[model samples]
Target chain A: MNSSSVAARGTVRVGPSGRYAWIALTAPLAIVLLLFLVVPILSLLRASFFEGDRSFNASGVSLEHYLRFLTDSYYLNVMLDTLGYGLATALLCLVLGFPTGYALARAKPHWRRWGLIIIILPLTLSLVIVVFGWLVVLGRQGLVNQVLVFTGLIDKPIRLLFNSPAVIIVLAQQFLPFMVLSVMSVVGHIDPTLEQASANLRANRWTTFRKVIVPLSLPGILSGLTLVFVLSVSAFITPRLIGGHRVQMLGSLIYEQIIVLLNWPFGAAMSAVLFTVTLTITLIVNKWLKSHPG
Target chain B: MQTRRTFLVSTVAAGAVLAAPAIVRAKPFDNVTLTLNGFGGDFDRIMKETVADPLKAETGLDVTYAPGGSSAAVAKTIATPDNPPFDIVLCDSPSVPELIKADMIDPVTPDKVPNVANLLPGLPEFGQHGVPFMISSSVITYNTEETQTPIASYADLARPDLEGRVALFNLENTGGVLYLLAMAEANGGGIDNIDPAFAALERIKPNIVTLTSSTVSLIQLFEQREATAGALWNGRVFAMQNAGQPMAMVAPSEGIYSLMSYYNPIKGTKHPEAVATYLNKALSDEAIGAIANFFRYGPTTTVDLPKAVADTIITFGPEGRAKIKTLDWTKIAEKRSGWIERFNRTMA
Candidate 1:
């Protein structure tokens, strides 16, 4: 073949030369990731085996911490609770966020702008402040209880904070914006004509939403789930603040070992477990989505 | 304009006169800035107002306060022994041994901190290694208005009437571990044998509203009437009462456990003299009184507190001294990790 034809074929193929260009483009980022992310995690993994408080002796390297976690039911329960809380948060966010996201996507300009602001306002505030605010709002004599008692709906205030329900509520509130924004972006991209076509075919509103809108927004929903799930699993502040000691998540457990007990080895080991669990769950979700694409 | 100028001139003159001693003493450390690390929350605020602010005004040493727990501070300092971030660190009694073991702190001599001579006897004396900052006793604090029956002992935390309405400290806190010791002692055990403590804690599991580290949460629990009683420091109980929460603290009949919070100068501080001067100021009569006024912790120094303030502070009064539970710091430093595990296990 002639040079021009060969070049055209090479461009279409994105051959080995293209691979080199791509690698070169991504090389700096790869190096950064290796240095900051991979190396630190590998160091944590290495440190996890060393016994004692920050003093790691090379001769004392063992799986004592991991063994403690594996044999102990208490640690296992914490692991289960962490994953369970993450799953509950992701599902709750989806349920609460999808409708709000859809409504925002379909709203008038002014209303949509304000609605978006309200949803994203929590993101602007720090997590500590958010949790503190929730504490005041959901405390035994908080706004809800005060209102209820004032209206003669209840004789006394109920215990609302520092429980599983309180944790779920706070987590849902903290991360709902992520879910909304993610789903909104995808919903905004869909052609309005599809919904109109579904309507013209006499599909009811609910039917249209389920059959057309939801399927179209599956990518966003899945992505939102992953983001929310990972964030919830790694959450330390909310449960720490409002959940009190009643609710224990993996993030707080790791914090307890590392900061409170000064057992860096055990803390690092717990961190490794968290990292592996989150990575495996994320990969599994991604693979499932890929295999069953909408 | 003439009157305003006169007022400004007089103010400047008076300020200079008052600051003359501090300025002279500060001449040597004119450019030095000491970093101080201590507990956060109310303690940080009180330390700033009572200790750091006055020291800065008197000595001209630019002090930066980094608030953190003692263990975390110890870990950070141990990680960088030769060039530590903090010039001086305020840690609880349990943390001193670990620091001493690591050789992170410089010894404090009476010559460096003359106020060390005024500290109460039998308080943890590191023999020039550390000086007592304040003394806090763990007590069973309750809302006087909420509960009909008075809580007289630590064991009263598990009273059936208090079920679902008690707030206790998490195991990692200094006051918290001390509370555990109190519980153990009340149940015929001590720190060395903490099994009884764990069992006692488990028995009170139903009454435990939460085991929290936040002083705000603990206060809110009582203020909102969610929790009627729990284990807390006498100073914290005093704070709650001062805030108009109708709170009262009961030093358990068995005995009360007190934590003698200590402060030490790190070995590699650039301004060791400045550190010494600041710590001396911290132990001064006026500063200690201010701390007692605000938080109700007993002054480590032998300053005669007014009766109103003295009544609330827990110290080595002939009777109070006899009741203070002695904790073995070295043993605690070794077994703390396991104790925390057991605490979590039982609570979880």
Candidate 2:
């Protein structure tokens, strides 16, 4: 090679060129992470430790807020209930979503597209609107009760809304799309020949699904569980709206402390706990998925 | 050279001073726009037509209204007290202590707003820092179509006949907190002691179809027949009644608490005089009457509203609205979070 051409090639291999490429790829995301996520989280953590009662302390910090959470059984119950509610919602979404996702994956192209659209249609609506829709459907004199009464199923309208079950149903409806879409993405990539091979091996449909298809979609299932569980745990509206006074989730408690009572320290402390628990759960699930390689 | 220059300057200064009165006569408002924090929807429309428009006309200052929740407004003010987002903010009386603590508001004086003298006798006087514009009340409302008997007192909620038919406010709401206090008072305890109220609430827990935090939820419960009787604001009950709902507003025999809406000039405002003037105009007879008619609230001022309009107002009774009760709001704010947590834990 000529000397000039060799010099140009040498320049291309320098660290600055590769460093520039890396920086270009990550700069925007790093800036966004610092400004929006990391900074806010640090501030919230700091605020969590501040002395607050009608106002936050500017001079000093304390652990009374966090200690309250540890000592107060009511708050402990709220945390446990929040986690339980999230788990139940996630499980419901998985069971109900898996079949729809599998059906979509196995359907014709047009059918698959239409089915996906219909499954995700509710996702486009705001949570408040969706809850309002549920209200109209599940209220005491709502559509379901009216229909049941018309069919002579019962003498009086059953109390259907304002309960934990209503909250779960609404939450399931809200998060089902996430579960279905994630599972569909994984299931769609599974080879049809593998299932056929299992069938040719004298495996029944249920066995084929259990042994072959389920393992292949484990990653999707894990991701959907993480998404639904995290969202459900952090949800404030569904529990407040559908659960009413019958149910009290951690999110609602946090909302009450901050917004209603203007108790920032306690609210921030509760939020920090929620964030830590959610992060620990997510990281553990992710680690499990990575270790299992499924 | 010095004498000639001084003469020239003096002539110009004198001429400008002589012409100042004519200039004042020409453009009174001088294109100043005042920002007001208020509630939206029908309240916004009524406030604009009755208070804002007339104030603008009288003072020559243009008015701009921004609406949001009182808590949000207080938060915003607290966030930027040095540079408040709005010139005037209409807030609830309960939030006054916090605002005062945060130093987010400026004090009013008699010279600034003459209408302050005309406010009702029992209303609060925050050293002129906040002025009560109107008084809204929390009352029990029943769906006439569904309810066979009138809800006469707070005790009626615990009766078996009202079982599974009542809806109460969630503790987050001021009305709900007042309800709790009223129940406590009726059940041999007072505001300082709310355990009795909790017991009362527990007794009526089966009757409470739901606990709501907003007028929309209360109205929905009534409309859907989920709740035949609910703890509701008198104004919303009136709105529902006007909307052709089979709803009736009842001032319970146990008494109801007043929720006073106050207007205050934001701290560090440039147009303090304009804000004070607007507040005064808001308290004027015509404006107060219009506001009372619109929201079905009692005017803080002694305005002679039409008899038909007066009949609908809770504070327009022959006893001159003296039956209303109120709690120590500062105490409420201090202990509210604990009470809410307890309520959440105890409620059905």
Candidate 3:
């Protein structure tokens, strides 16, 4: 209660004051955000306001690039192509991935481990490497074609590398693990007794699966769908390498605008649109799942 | 409530970004950090020796070499921020537009690096904001051991004999399209004439063993003789030939499709002066010769070389590697999507 003790107590309340810790935390985080995300995004946004060469207008901003993208059939087609392809890839992943995930979740432990490993292998490899492997096999007059031709499958080798098929196939394969992993995480957590109990009620296996298993795994299914949808929508390498420039996906278009064309603002706009679209789809799907109570 | 998560994430992100400009976090002086970003592999060594060594010797700078490949990566870093990992960016021709659009790379006044005059003539058109460093081309290269007949033109490959025996870089860059355009013109169709070119390729559709984006793939395919002929950068051919791969680099009767490599100093680089200095050394006769020797491409320096060095350069000379092709990048850039679409639909 003495004045000296009161001052000592005040010092103890805010002991060891220093600026380094704040700087240490803020600095790295700031660097990551600015260097990786914000700067690119901001530059891209700023670039969109201006067009080709002339330093950004000091006077004001314009929507010239937006107008250009909107008005041009070419770019519109590109955007549509991206959405269509992305949706297709997502759907294909769901179809291919869900069964595999279900099987893995319900299978014997050793078989499940091997299945998970098989599914996860591509996830560990760089995207460029996997796509390159596909091209070597699926390309026109490639190994498969060579084998087929040698076996007299056809008179001519086929062109198979750059197309919608390759794009969808590669994307489904690329994002398959994401779908499987997500679905498996949910399905694995579900009570097997629910399905077995339904079976005990004399529900057929198919009936139990459709009524109990499918409904129960709905959350996981939604998560997997959202995951695959978002990834497929934003996939640049798949469309660029396998889709060719022919199949203009949103991810590649963003890349073309910002990285290739150096139109930062326009690319930013494109990215913003892409982000919104992805978010909206994910939200919608989640809402649908919740309403269904699955 | 639904948006709370996204809003929080974005808020934190924005705050961090706002705080970044002030986060200098100084290291030390004469620690003049020079990040030399360029091509990978042996090219990394040449950059280390030619540009990096001399700069470090004189300036006591901490020169770090980032072995990044492709224009997109360099451009991506430059576009990201005022403080990028790369200080000096060495990019090829196609990337100039990307850099200019982002304004990620500042234009260097020739006065900064007066040595740029020694660069090839047509460089200005290709690189407006950057300096031309070296020239690399997509030329027709073949394994001499594979074919008995002398391969001369792209049309030659269209023969049934070559069916399922050729390798090609995928239909992504202007290089492939340039060759296609040349074939189009030769087939009497012209630059926009993709149909004839497609028709030509269709003849030997089976011959195009694989479509690869990486130069390494094409080289591998050739080395294994999985494919007899390939369209590759002149450097790859020269390097492979020198490595005793039994390959012949042909300037092709249709002309070589090329990307005039340019050196770009990134914007927001505090070491702009140092970066410019390295670029100058890279374009220097000694440095260019060393790189040329290592890479198997011609030097950018307009210096007379020792006869030993003469064997390496792919000179455009009087006929100017006449038969080889230079791409109409503008046209190719415009119709790329359409061409790719049609190509995929028809070929796929």
Candidate 4:
């Protein structure tokens, strides 16, 4: 082949050889995913349809577990509450993360590195430890109460932990870095001259940010929201520790079924439902994002 | 060039030298290792220092420890029955029935472990599939500095003054199950009729701040003064008190709910001989005494303890043991899931 053709071949394109190369490159990953992910999921789905305990299937296949979960008002409420918490956490993270991510993207190289390190520091610690740290800070005689009482805001310490707000706040804090990192990656690639050009066209700071910056950063915002929401809904330890008995999430319920109660079939059914719901939401979001490309 | 006699003599001498070490080092069950699922943290340390190391010296067999809760152990066994993770499991009373029902454990008889004979009377009646090693009771534990009034009975938890201060155990924990049973019996109901338990829970619902299955989180709650009083295992209470925390435990007027922890040999263990030997060692006076001294749990074997220590352990003597209210574990295991769901609903 000529030099141009060789160069063209080196650069990936949609041809028979390129397609084969792509297949070869992804073959290992495809095998790994099939073995670890798809196989286990299929097994879980099968277990969900089993009539009796995982060890015994003599009773035949049925959807009794699913019916029970769907029909029960208590389980339905838990599912709704979990989704609500996920949405609230995603919104909270977006509100807090957008500015931080923007600042980091526009910062000097050294400052940006330090900012990234600070954002990622909590992720390095164990989730259990972080939850415990939150307990100490939000307890009745904790820092917030102490500060409030000292300032004469209240005469006595109020209950700060073991409630819905605490669970959402702690979850948002736990997953904030994911949102920030997602936004930062995409925002960093956006041309700053566009914002300057918008300013030159007599647009105010807020207007420029709203019309130009936000629209440009749509991909990052969508990804961050999806990531945070999915993670928040499936989180068990944080809600269990912080929300206590008053707040019951679907994740903790599923955990109780599988680990504590040892009801594998019921747990599998709940898991299948959660997976389906999450996957469906993700697919719809992706489709919407594709249709409304920035 | 060498004579036959000289060659034979030299060969025999070499053989004797090589065989002498083997003869001297020969031990029953040598090179055999068994894994035991034990309670982690200080319990594992005490067991290692008391039972595991001594058993290793007594027999050439080695005993490795894997630390986790009894439920986790049972679940692992059920998941992999043929090739179980641990050869032997240490489980509580609630788990014993489940294990028996599943036929996951082998019957540990007097022929295998001679020390099984020394176990407290009536323990053998509980089950022969495993050897009982330690005894603990569920009692009311409170932070003395934080609690204003003395807690005497389980019903006192419903007092208006202690509202929103109590930290309770969720139904998943064995202690939690015992608490519910104790509440039921204290009221007009028993294990068969648990409606009274739910009613009592409703009465005390205003006082409940948190319900959890974690011992560590419970202790943290006490340390942080988030919980003033709640039901907890006596051993953990004693540990916290010994650590200089202002914690005290009371055997309520209702009666102490006793629990027996057992060492069960898996049914299909490759090292049955080693497991039996290890159990015997674990049930010996020295091992049981060490565990009692460290954890303040009543010893299943007839090992003598100091009067002060014995007095502290509610299940130590006949009188203390008499105060223990035993329930039908089979019924508890059968109704546990439903009870847990109801408890969650009631508390929620």
Native interface contact recovery, all models: 0.62, 0.69, 0.10, 0.69
TM-score of each predicted structure versus truth: 0.88, 0.88, 0.71, 0.93
Model 1 spans > 4 angstroms off: A1-36, A53-60, A108-110, A150-153, A288-294, B1-26
Per-residue CA lDDT of model 2 for B9-54, tens digit only, reads 9999999999998777664565788887778888888888887787
* Candidate 2 interface RMSD after superposing interface residues: 1.7
Per-residue C-alpha lDDT of model 3 across residues B16-110, encoded as one tens digit per residue: 89878546433232578777665788887777787677666665566777765555665557545656667767776655665665567777766
What candidate 2 keeps of the native contacts, as a fraction, is 0.69
Return the TM-score for candidate 1, rounded to 2 decimals.
0.88
DockQ, per-model, please? 0.52, 0.54, 0.09, 0.64
Decreasing DockQ order of the candidates: 4, 2, 1, 3
| Candidate with the larger DockQ of 2 and 3 | 2
**Colliding residue pairs in candidate 1:** B108-B128
**A1-294 per-residue lDDT for model 2 (tens digits):** 776797787745446677679788999999999999999899888888887554433536899889999898878988999999999999999999999988898999999989988997888898889989999999877899999999999898899988888999899999999999889988999999999999999999999989999999998999999999999999998898888887879998887777767777788899999999999999998998998776
Task: Pick the TM-score winner.
Answer: 4
**Model 4 DockQ vs. reference:** 0.64
lDDT tens digits, residue span A178-290, model 4: 99998999899999999999999999999999999999999899999999999999999998999998889999998888877778889889989988898999998899889
Q: Is candidate 1 or candidate 3 better by DockQ?
A: 1
Runs in model 4 lying further than 4 Å from the true structure: A1-19, A53-59, A150-152, B1-31
TM-score of chain B of 4: 0.94
